[model samples]
Target chain A: MSEIINVSAIAKVEKEKIRKRIESFRSNGKATPTLATVLVGEDPGSVYYMDMQKKVLESLGGTMLKLTLTEDVSEQELLSTIGDLNNDDKVHGIMILFPLPKHIDEHKVAMKISPSKDIDGVNPMNIGLLASTSGGIAPCTPSSVVEILKDTLGELKGKHAVIIGRSNIVGKPLIQLLLREHMTVTVCHSRTRDLKEVARSGEVLISAMGRPKMITEEYVGDGAVVIDVGTSELDGKITGDCDLESVMKKASLVTKVPGGVGTLTTTILMRTLVDLYEKSES
Target chain B: MSEIINVSAIAKVEKEKIRKRIESFRSNGKATPTLATVLVGEDPGSVYYMDMQKKVLESLGGTMLKLTLTEDVSEQELLSTIGDLNNDDKVHGIMILFPLPKHIDEHKVAMKISPSKDIDGVNPMNIGLLASTSGGIAPCTPSSVVEILKDTLGELKGKHAVIIGRSNIVGKPLIQLLLREHMTVTVCHSRTRDLKEVARSGEVLISAMGRPKMITEEYVGDGAVVIDVGTSELDGKITGDCDLESVMKKASLVTKVPGGVGTLTTTILMRTLVDLYEKSES
Candidate 1:
């Protein structure tokens, strides 16, 4: 039987370490780091996610400032609110929660978030800096996956890493992280021909395609290390990209759906806030 | 014998098109486009390249403004000079010539260049936008290479494009451009293991590693399209990363040095300026 990896366990330990570091900042006479999240229109999923994020930050001894706006809020009003938080000395990080209303231009709003306070790494300036050099905050979910991989596998240098998806939030940013580790990286997407052959070729496989149970036994090789970043809703049930039952049997290591990358994202988001806060201060 | 692709021939035609377009803008009572180039030191190669850029812009109905600086200029002074050009209404595009003195922080200076005026696309915001979405100006060299390939190869939709460098200038941005065309792209750099195997695996091979004659016949496959972006100064002579004679024999098409992507870069810079100007005006 292959190794069933526990990413949440690793994240728990890392989260405590971040909390300890936050304490050091506090002891040094610095203000406690604050995260400001902007939510446009209260979707059930986004609200739930924001609440979970708030709880995670509180547990880590950080503050979560929720800025809830109506769906019909003008772009200028939204930008004005975000500008206020950016100038707030106590605010260290800002995240615009996903699924902003259709009327609001998401791209324009994302750009308005200050790079220093851009904890989610959605700003092009922050994202560009992350890819251009080793600078800037990495996107939360992918950063967590990479942190987990680093902890699980000591040296990723020269490993053949294959990613399924070319999303800015996940696959694209993850490619930059893996490349920084000197790994041979290949990104396969929907238009990619011979997906199965490409997936089987990698020693480290990452799937962020958001398709439920898309990666089957046919896509995995013997003893491949698989990281599933997919969260698709099917019949009101959440599942990952990889087929847990089959991937566990075929792969040497696997992260399960509900308890794997998903669980760590909140903690990772909080950790990123602390890191960005420290960086901005220094 | 394989086809010897004349990239300069294609570039010449495109340059004329841009010149004609500039004439139309002139007739419309608009001011001529101007390029502002910043030179920090008196390096011969940098001077030569800057002169080439100047002549290209002038030849294509544009103006070039050279701002020479002392080698010992402080970072603040350099940024101050850049800030002036950014606010200058006549300056449509700005390019900071490479190889600044060791004392200056290149990254900080690059960040200071305004994205709208950044013709070379050195700013991380532009690079990141190019990568993250289908928006923003692409770096000249890579954008030229993609345009040449698009002109030569009718549809790059399903082609396997491989790049042998991960530099922000050529390889990284080039990967984004190719990916936008729906090609299966793989990027390999100096740390890539089994370089020869990786080179032979792709149908479209690009070498931008800046190592003279690094890619020989053994690294190429039959009927592959080879684009060399390397320009290494060896024994006071310029040569590409590809062993051109050997690669030409193996590949179906090849872009030769001195007349390949390099020739199209200046024209593309002017084109990007016109594009940005139009975008800003609109």
Candidate 2:
């Protein structure tokens, strides 16, 4: 029987490290690292996510500054807010919540975030860092995948990894990280002609295509480690790209939709904030 | 018998397109795109490359601004020169001759070039664009790979591709591009275990690891399309990462060392210069 990889245990350990780091920073009177979460429009999902993240930061002894803007917030107004945050030394990290109003140019707003304070690591600087393999902050989702894989797989050197989806946030950056680890990594997306054949070849499979339950048993090789970064609401419940019920049966380790990567993502964000703070001071 | 992929033909077509585009831009009275080639030292290869590229641009009615600096040029001076070039509106692109002086921080210098003027597409902004998949100039070698793949494969959707090497210049960004094309892309490096198995599964195999003749017939499948992006001097002879004499027999299509991607790289740079000029004006 293949061993089950339970991330909750590892996540708890990492969380403690994050919490302790935050506590040390707080006790040192080095201002608590602060993240500014800018939300435009009222999406319940966005709100819930923001609140949960804020709480997570609070629990870790970090500060969360929530800036709420109306759905009709002009592009100029948003840009100004980001500019203001960029100048604020108190703000170590700034994240403009995704799914911005249609009228807003997301890329422009992203560009405004200071590369130094870009804890969410979605800014162009971080993206460049990933592309060049030089040191820079990493995008949260992909960084989390790297951390989890390292924890579960020990060393990724020479491992064959196949990624489903090529979204900027996950697949592309994840490929960069895997390359750094010296893993044989493959990225498959919508344009892919033979998905199953490609997936079956992986020692590691990462599903982040935003599709719900698309990966099945046929796509998995025996003893393959599966990480599902996809989050979709199916039947009023959150689900991942991999159909865990069947995949879990064939895989050595599989991350479930809800309790798997999603749980670790925000935690990683908090850790990134502390790291950024330390980096800034150094 | 598998048909040999003639990359030179594809490269010639692209070169012709660039030549035509430059001519068209010049005739339209558009700012004839100019690329300033900055050389820090007296490296023969660097000098040759710069002169060759300048000739290519000049033939197309574009201008080349040559800045030849002493080998002992200070970092501050180099940076200031880059700054000056950035402010020069007529200089649409800047190409820094590679292998700078030992004391210089190449990455910092590379980052200093304005993204709008980075015709070689080595700037952080372009690298960030590569990571984001939102579209930006890509490193010339990798971008050429993408261009060649599209011409040969029709559309790479769902193809299994493996890249050997993880250098910032090639492997990381190439993976991102391949992923963008909807191909299953894998990166394999020296630390990888079972490298042969990984290489054999790829419908497309790209060797960029700078190692000379590292990929042999044993490392490839029966009909894999091979792209060798490596340029190494072995015993005073230029060669690629693939053992072409043998691997060519196995590959359905193969790119030759000096005549393949390398020949197309400079033309792509010219294309990027024109592209930058167009983007800036638009």
Candidate 3:
């Protein structure tokens, strides 16, 4: 018989610790950690995410500064605004909301922000840090995924983790992080010949292919821990890459769609802000 | 049964093409390739390598400029020398030989070279380029390994490769390169448990650990393509990480100790210099 690992319980414990840390920092005379959210266009999902993030930070005794720019803003203007925030001591961390206007070079805008103030860790400097294995800020989504896994699995030293999806966001960075933790990681993408065979090799499975219920019972072995980082709207509701009904039976632990990684992501953003604030003082 | 793949014949054909390319560039006036080698001490192995590299470059019509610094050159002096090389218009690429005197900070010195002239690809800027997936130059040894794999396998998408050893020079950079090629890469180190099991899982096995003949027949899967990147002196003779006798039996394709990656590394270095030279002119 395999023991069932409760992912929600682990996430709760992490969230509680983060909440207490924020409170302690607030009480200590340190400036309340602030995250500046910059949006280039009218993205409904981005707006909703910003609002939810603002509420979460507020709950944790942190503050959010929103900067909305029109879609017509020139590239130079956007860069200038980012440069200003970089120089401002008040802004502890900066996250430029994605889905920018088609005309703008997103990579240029990302490079404009100082790496020290980059809460999203999408900047080239932080990416280099992750690749170099020297340790610095890491991409938030993948970093959070590892944190969740570590909290549940303890040390990941010898574990075999197979990742579905080879996007720069999740698969690439996650491979590097897992390597740092000494886990043997395999990444499969759309080009993979045998997806189920690859998934069955994993003691830990991470699905980030953005497909609704892509991972079925065939992809999972008994006692496997599955982390679904995909969120797709199906039938007017949120669904994940893993088929919960079938995968849950085979998985020792599993993360649900709306309640799983999405919740931890914003919490990680708050933590990034706090980390930046502390580094500034030190 | 899985189909057996023969890699050595393909590698030889590719090697011949690469050799011809080097020869054509050497005789042609269009690309004047040059590599500058900087050596600080008088180590016997380093001297032999430096001499052999010079001969190889000259044979390929590339010029090699040797700069021998004193054993006790100050950090400032070393920096200034590298600065001169950075500013030299004739020098297309610069490489600081390994095992500098104990007084100098190797990382600081490596960082000082202009990224465009960093033929070795150890500079932070080039590292950043590789990390960002923007296709920048890479360290010669790992770069050669990837080139060999791709030349033999023909686009290594979704291939499972496991690399032993986590040295900055090989393991980390190789992961970045393999990820770029869309191969799922796993890196294992001294701390890794069940090392043989990990090595056996790889369809492509890269042994970079310095221990001579460390990878045995048991660590290799049938028909696995093996690349031995280690060069160690065992009983006054050069030996590799893979046990040639046993590994050759299990491996459908294998690179021997002296004739394997070592032969290709300096050739790759010359190729990198030619690339930098062309980029500079453009």
Off by over 4 Å in 1: none
Model 1 lDDT on a 0 to 1 scale? 0.87
Query: Candidate 3 lDDT, tens digit per residue, B1-282?
Result: 222334345445544655676677656756567788988879777888889879877876678999998888898998999999999988999999888888898878867988889988777657766777565678989988987887767879888888997776898789788877877776778877788887887889999998998889899988889898998999999999988888877787788887777767877777788778878877
Give the alpha-carbon lDDT of every model.
0.87, 0.84, 0.82
TM-score of each: 0.96, 0.95, 0.91
Q: Candidate 2 docking category?
A: medium
Summarize candidate 1's per-residue lDDT along A1-282 as a digit string, tens digits: 888788878988988898999999889998899999888998999999999999889988899899899989988899899999889888999988878877788898889889988988899998888888988778988898888889899898878788999999998888788888998888889988888877887888899999999899788878899999999988898989988888877788999888889888988888889888888789
lDDT of 2 by residue, B1-282 (tens): 555567778767877887788788778777778889999989999999989988878876788999999999999999999999999888888888889999999888889999878877677778887678568677788888988889988978878888888777787778767767767677788887888888898899999988899889899898999999999999999999988888977888888887888877877777788788888778
DockQ rank order: 2, 1, 3
Flag the better candidate by DockQ, 1 or 3. 1
DockQ of each: 0.70, 0.73, 0.50
Clashing pairs in 3: none
Relative to the real complex, the DockQ score for model 3 comes to: 0.50
Q: Determine which window of 10 residues in candidate 1 chain A has minimal summed lDDT.
A: A97-106
Q: After TM-score superposition, what is the CA distance of residue A203 in candidate 2 from its true location, in Å?
A: 1.3
Per-residue lDDT for A39 in model 1? 87
Query: lDDT of model 1 at residue B245?
Result: 90
Chain A TM-score of candidate 1 vs. true chain A: 0.97
Clashes of 2: 12
Docking verdict class for candidate 1: medium
